[model samples]
Target: MAYGLSEEEAVSSISLSPCEIMGIEKDYGSIEKGKKASFFVSKGNALDMMTNQVTLISIDGVVQSTSNFQYELYLKYRKKDTTN
Candidate 1:
């Protein structure tokens, strides 16, 4: 991203660099049929997604909640503390 790589190039970097850098291309950094489906889902294209939040996230195909703990805490305490 610092080098101004396009969104596609950036995406491919994450998917391929790990394999090349760590020498683990055989097992990680890809979505093979037998490998785990550790990926996330976004509503828009990579660059455009800056304004769009991630809608779904998963690890090894296990869906994870996107709840923001800090935001929740703020909401929980904002009413209690009228200092804002």
Candidate 2:
């Protein structure tokens, strides 16, 4: 956005534009019928790391678990140490 691109353009540059440049737009890029359904749902602007909290993800039309090993470890360690 600092480069003057709108939010939509910024997003497209990373998503749709790349696929189109790679000649895979027919199967990737912007969501459409018959196209591969793969994307992540974020709580806020995906362009902003501070606000881009991914809550869900889908790949080839299948929902995937968002929790990863690091996230799981964080969750486990975030609890107060009862044995202390």
Candidate 3:
């Protein structure tokens, strides 16, 4: 089997089907937030997964800084142990 469908086709399929079925036709298939934060952020090209990087990740308005966040988290935890 072929590995993938054309990008245009793939986007069209999802944009028309599930969004309509679930009655989220106005917001879910696009960038409207009140519907859901379920979408991808692409850099340069949408399908270019290798070079496309996620700069930030947020959930329910709680921001997560992917860049130094991991290191910061480790430091926070380490400090807690040291102060005990």
Backbone clash count for every predicted candidate, in the order shown? 0, 0, 0
Compute the lDDT of residue 78 as modeled in candidate 1: 77
lDDT tens per residue, model 1, 1-84: 547987768877878686679887666677787777777777776446475567888787899988898979988987795665
Point out the higher-scoring one by TM-score: 1 or 2. 2
Instruction: Report the number of the highest-lDDT candidate.
Output: 2
Off by over 4 Å in 1: 73-84
How large is the C-alpha RMSD of every model relative to the true structure?
3.6, 1.7, 7.3
lDDT by residue (1-81, candidate 3, tens digit) is 125777776675656568888987775665565765555444565456567677656543456656587878888887674
Candidate closest to the true structure, highest TM-score? 2
TM-score of 2: 0.88
Off by over 4 Å in 3: 1-4, 13-16, 31-40, 56-84
> lDDT of candidate 3?
0.63
| Candidate 3 structure, TM-score to reference | 0.40
Error in Å for residue 83 of model 3: 30
Candidates by TM-score, descending order: 2, 1, 3
- Cα displacement (angstroms), candidate 1, residue 9, comes to 1.3
